[model samples]
Structure formats: C-alpha cells, structure tokens
Target: MTHASCEPARITEPDLIAIRDDLASREPIFHRPEWGSTRADFERMIAEGFWETGASGRRYSRAFVLDELERRYASPPLDDDWESCDFHCQRLAADIYLLTYSLRQGARETRRSTIWQRAGSDWKIVFHQGTIVQDA
Candidate 1:
C-alpha cells in the first residue's frame, strides 16, 4: 500500500497543530537528547504496558526496550542524523492520539506510528511500531 493510505484521518486544525507541535519534536523517540535521553527519562515517558514492533517486525516489551535503550545510551555514540516527514495525527480518543510519519536514517527508510496519551501538558507513549519502506 502507498504511504498515503497510512494516514487515515485528520484531526481538527487546532489540535492538529498543537499535537504536531507537541509530538513532532519528541519523535524518532529516544533520539532527542534535548528531551532527556536518560533511562529514567525514558521510563517516565513510556506507559506501563508500552510495546513496540520494530522495523524488523519483531515485537519488543517495555522492559526489553527500556533496558536496551539504557545500555545503548550509557556510552552515547556520535549523534545519529535522521529526518522525518509525512506527518499525520488522528485523534483516537480524548487525549489519545495516533501519530504517523516516515523516517529516514541514512539509506534506511521506515514508516513509523506512535500512540500517545496526553496527561495534562505531558505525554506518554502507549504503543509504537515501525515498518521498513521498501525501495521502488
């Protein structure tokens, strides 16, 4: 299916802007050092039952993902250069949003989706997944 089909709905204009603003900067999750890259920070931002399907199609549990992230960041490597675009936000329920975007890291391109729940002004990720975008 084309990337366009992935974006199924559009939120209201105002919420669209606010959600895009609130979420865009925090995405490609765990990559934004400005938002705190520590394990504790990661823990705080993730829901208790957080799970993810990696671009490789394997599901990862909350503890596994968190531990791996902590290990990877313990001695942070050179900053990764990635770009994300084709953003779309759909309101799933009150204060819950599904954000979809495409991410490029060097030669690898992937479609990403994150389910986030808003808690006042802060947000926590409930679920996330990524699928590799095949070359034409």
Candidate 2:
C-alpha cells in the first residue's frame, strides 16, 4: 500500500487580488461621513478574536475597538480627506489572507496590514496593524 500526502489548494494571483479588493472596499465603512451609518456598518462585520494595533502604538482587542469606534462616532465631525496606496495581498493558507496598504490623511501617513480568516460563510478580520510612517 502507498501513502500519499495531501497538499492545500492553490490560488492564482488574479483570484487573490479579487479577494483583497473585495475586503478593502469595506474600509470606508468605518469612516463614512455619517456617524450613524458608520456605526451601523461597523456592527455587522466585526468578528470574535479581532485584534488591531493603533497608529498611536497601542494594542486593541475587539471590545476595545468597538468602544473606541463608538466614542469616535459620537465626537464632532471633521473634514477628513484620505489618500490610499496600492493594496498588496497574499494567501497565507486555504482560508487565510494577508493584505497591506498605506493611507495618508492630511500630513500623516500610516502603513497598515490585516489578516483575514474565513468565518463560516463570510470573511472576518483576525488581526490588524497600523504603523505611522515618518516619511511619506
């Protein structure tokens, strides 16, 4: 009898790009012009075990992110114009993906990345990090 090893499924670059682009579209949900709309959007997508690193050098848990998001939503509005860099995505596993990009709002630019995992029928962000870039 011969034993065979099973390899994971393969993903093409184009497919990976599509997946990444789809996820990126969700970003504006957090920063929409209308606070009420943003809050409503945030509530639907957050998943368990979500963690993120803030540009301020602080680590936040899912609960903390939610709380902070709510507080920010309640604060006075601001004039925010943001520019984003090209997105890069990689498939870490059959169901895991990594995405990286940069966004500049005003004079501050931050490089950000996120790891997304398949959660049942939908995708959810498992980890995220944002680092301030000294030079644009």
User: Which model scores highest in TM-score?
Assistant: 1
Over the stretch 23-120, how does candidate 1's per-residue lDDT look in tens digits? 98899888888887788999989999899999888999999999998998889657787899877788889998888889998888999999999987
The alpha-carbon deviation from the true structure for residue 14 of candidate 1, after best TM-score superposition, in angstroms, is 4.1
Q: Report the CA-based lDDT of candidate 1 relative to the real structure.
A: 0.87
> What lDDT tens digits, residue by residue, belong to model 2 across residues 51-107?
888888889888887787778868775766887766777888989988777888878
- Every model's TM-score: 0.88, 0.74
Which run of 10 residues does model 2 get worst, by summed lDDT?
1-10
Residue 80 C-alpha lDDT in model 1:
89
In the predicted model 2, the residue pairs found to clash are none
Question: How far off is model 2, as Cα RMSD?
Answer: 8.9
Model 2 TM: 0.74
